[model samples]
Target: MAPIINGRLLFNQLPNGLPVPGKTTVYDASETIDLETAPLNGGILVKILVLSADIYIISRMRDSSVEGRSSPFLLNQPIDNYGVGLVLRSEHSSFKQGDHIYGMLPFQQYIVMPPATAERFTVLSNDAGIPWSAYVGVCGMPGQTAHHGWREFSKAKVGETVFVTSGAGPVGATVIQMAKAEGLKVIASAGSDEKVAFIKSLGADVAFNYKTEDTREILAREGPIDVYWDGVGGEALEAAIDAASVGARFIECGMISVFTGEPYHVKISFNIVTKELKISGFIVTSLHQAHLSHFYETFPKLVKEGKIKYKEDVTQGLERAGHAIVDVITGRNKGKSVILVGEE
Candidate 1:
């Protein structure tokens, strides 16, 4: 098979002289990716294998400043985010040729980076006996988001009751199992019936179809949630606020529901004050430095022992990345949506 280049690059301005719709464009780079021509001054070159499409990218696409966080993707350049890749050539001794690793990579056929720049992602191997993609899913940033959201902030205790929004997504699925592991009764909500059933398979005590079932009614029936792990905000958040226990802890991770170019109408501030809920917003990047080691040490065991399971809707080839990104954000993806950039 011939090598194919299908990555997309984003720019700030369109050809018509207006600002780029959302800092995006698609171009072919097959001939432009010769390793001989790639910069080799003092860094490693990685060939991405599996790249993830995340909901947060949707937030970036809409040109909104999400909680004052700057766009990770820059204008007039390829975007960058988490990707699993192999070091094809390296100036650094530690990252020699053929080392499988995962971390943020520019959206191109290959990306050069100083080994010292980003934190090194632990290499995956058959010896570890888990799919490499798990590093970017249940055992990766999304996993840590669920873990820290429930454990550190929510302070969810054994036998307590917890509710998580976006129950079918990557982070949501992990949160359900992790909550169960800690002996918490978990209830989760998703937009589709299939998602509701999938979350139930993941051991959620109660799973509801938020699309058809009224979140307020469901919460009223489920009731007195000790913790509200919110990955989707808006009306669901309002319902969570209304049903929270007296001292409920509301963990705000990512708000996927309202990220599109629409005015936010759901208001839960009054409920927050009256119910005296403890709400905290968190970014996964903030904990990357502090908790990186913990994720590496624990993720493998969870996969090997079957304590955790992951689902992925894989879209082959890099050209599919654009649609895949939109799918994940719109909840069209059943689990984590990944673009397979290369073969195993």
Candidate 2:
């Protein structure tokens, strides 16, 4: 059943000892959305079409107030992330009725969003000409992360050997593609042999199963990688550190391997003091301005030319969001996991 407009409130809770649960209520939105106070000028009402469930969301369950970074997933609020939606109502100057857009939206049935919210929501262009889910993957956060992190942080050179963990994931896949495009020799690692094959298909020079082959053994053969794109941290990070080249650059993106439970501690074989390597952790939110500009400036063109490809593991309905999120977090689903919120 479709949610009753302005009469429903969805809340997500991750209590101390309980598993995460999403609760829905037929409540008034007048209190939550401030409907009476919402600006009448150029606002949009969107029904989500597809939503992304990334592993980083787990960190939001940690200490809420840390380093002045407030998490979006509060104790009892509905979680929100990048989602593609269809415009149901438009009172805004920029958007017309029935426009398709992608942006940060709550995990619910409907969102009456303001025009400012639409600023981040791009009108899906035809040049890319792919599935709407691509907006949540390559043309979205993951792809942008790979481009920006490599260009700005790593400054990866042409001949550099770039190592990427979780290479079968949307972000890591793009990292491998971009690295290969830049003429960098790419080495990738994943959890399974199947993922290793997929990584190799994406042009990774060498792909390994971290579960069986041992990352250390693989790195020993391809020692001295110049840039380590640390997407799956913990023990993988430890291994990458040992294999890094002198003055290597490590861009810490996601730590999926250690996102849940107690963090893993792996003693490094190399002396950072002697190796002179640099490791920097980056949150996509911090580089918002740059990412937004890059999204508009580059993505459409790449898509038009068929230069960029995105893969999505789509689940059919909104009711399945929780399972999809779990699948994404646990790496059970290959590629990006999205909840298909609307029919074509």
Candidate 3:
């Protein structure tokens, strides 16, 4: 017998700031599907096991028409992001009942994808020896973002000094460690003292709380930086521009400071020409195929050997997903924000 599925929907659009609780509605539905009687036409039904709560989802909530990305969630539709799930029934040749998979999925308890969309799902290997949550995190998109941002965008070389902002967050944390592994001298900045220490423990040569210190002064003292991996924009980006060495590469992965509809005015435009710096902005989706493949092949080995480390700040239950997203955007989360939707 198929189980009843409860789903969460975005009840309203967030025009400016943080998400409100009532904006995400939860309701029970009577819809159910029997695996035996399900039609085999390249469709698949999955039981969602984990949902990733990230600032990127917040960006989507603010505007539904973000070009080169998934269409924004409709007024009453379920929010979608990366998720891990178990196949309950499958009509696709690549998947079968009982298979675990990861892909872009909704925040609901169960989902049905038609033939065209079903191709987005990828089967998870049980022998991978990593937690499912890792698939939505370190071993997933964030990991790929870090790897490709450094290798292709930043073009960091051995012994060069690199600075990373929001170093305690998923992508920044991975960037810090990967830079260290490749023999780069790494300096990291975070919002709080605890987060500063966390990045330091991950092998950052120097870590500081940007909240308490002036980023410009800190970078001036520690820099002449060859590469800058920017996760937080606004003031941090201005600081990087001012502190960059000649021919430095600035890889812009995100701008969390302005994601909540805050007004941002870039004040360091003049420095770009004066310093001969190369600035590039990237979305992980553009480099997904090559970087994701390289990350999967290499990252797990580093995780097993203790050369890389990751952390997930998980909130239990799907209901807390909104709160988790708010917490991560506001710097309240200590690690990667994740919603534990089911038992491992």
Candidate 4:
């Protein structure tokens, strides 16, 4: 077979703020590979089909000496995120040709899965027949984050009110639905009226545009928040802390405002002691071994039955990946941002 374009996005430089496409990150299209003849070396050859643009990836774009959720991205290397891909060829027992793999795959059109790093990639059973794109978005890591984050952190009784920050995101939207499903009142916020409407459509009982509304006033009016689904950190977190009910549980799933700058001062730090507020944060991957299978089995069925609403904002091409990731970082994406690198 003829050689093919192996366009890959690289961490060209460390970002000072939100990364600029083609500047801090380099989209290299000059690379090419003969997929039919590429050596697998006891691993797999995969056509990168779908890539998720997640906020978590932004934290990894930093100095190697700096701490992050994972290792910092090495300069000139293909940066990666959670994605589902199609295996074109495989030299492993657990995977075979035509199997779809899910893991932290690089932002490339094609990738060689050398055995050394292939340990992280797992075959997507896809038993529910959910769209492969969903496997990278609502049914993927973000969903697991919401499901387990809610299940583990939320111990509120029925009729409780939970305020979900960054409420229009993949994780927040899912949390909103789950809270409503369990008979809890959902108060969530987004960056725009459109996003506020989207979360309301998912049954958020009280949805607000945090960008325009006074975060503190609104949470105070509608809450004594029984649970704070804290995806947004910084000032929003400060507001949530003030609005929290005595003994409120704070579920820390993400702190995305690191890109937006840290505006949090914890002036009400005394509440943690006086109110007995329970604040807990979890790295979703650490909890997935016991819970991800339940998410994989149940969330897709809920989405399919229209019982749990979900959405995917699919960017059309790999060339747009850098922009797609920027959208996630800046809260510009309308739904779960996914870069469609190839036909699923």
**Which pairs clash in the backbone of model 1?**
none
Model 1, which residues run further than 4 Å from truth? 1-24, 62-67, 115-127
Pairs in clash, predicted candidate 4: none
Which whole-number lDDT from 0 to 100 does residue 157 have in model 2? 82
Alpha carbon lDDT of residue 249, candidate 4?
95
- Candidate 3 lDDT tens digits, 215-286: 888889989798999887898888889889989999999888887546678797878998899998888878
Q: Output the number of the lDDT-best candidate.
A: 4
- What is the per-residue lDDT of model 2 for residues 1-344, given as tens digits with 9 covering 90 to 100? 33354322244454352235353211224433443344446788776778887776665555465543536466455567788888776887778877888778877667778777777777876465667787888877787787778767887888999889989898899888888998999989988787888888888899988888878888889867999999878888988888888899999998876755567987865556678989888877677776667665787678667776656788876666766776777777877787776664
Best by TM-score: 4
Cα error of candidate 4 at position 229, Å: 0.5
The TM-scores of all predictions, comma-separated, are 0.88, 0.86, 0.93, 0.97
lDDT of 1 by residue, 1-344 (tens): 34445455453332222122243545445344556566666778778887877887654543333354746444566656677888888887667788888777665666677767534655565366777777778777688787666656878789989999888898989889888998999999998998998999999999999879888887898787999989887777888888888889988987776654464677756777777899999887777676666766776788778888888888887666666776776788988887777775
Q: 1 or 2, which is superior by TM-score?
A: 1
**Would you list the rank order by TM-score, best first?**
4, 3, 1, 2
Backbone clashes in model 2, listed as residue pairs: 42-91, 42-92, 49-341
Shift in Å, residue 110, candidate 3: 1.0
Quantify all predictions' global Cα lDDT against the true fold.
Answer: 0.75, 0.74, 0.80, 0.87
Q: For candidate 1, what is the TM-score? A: 0.88
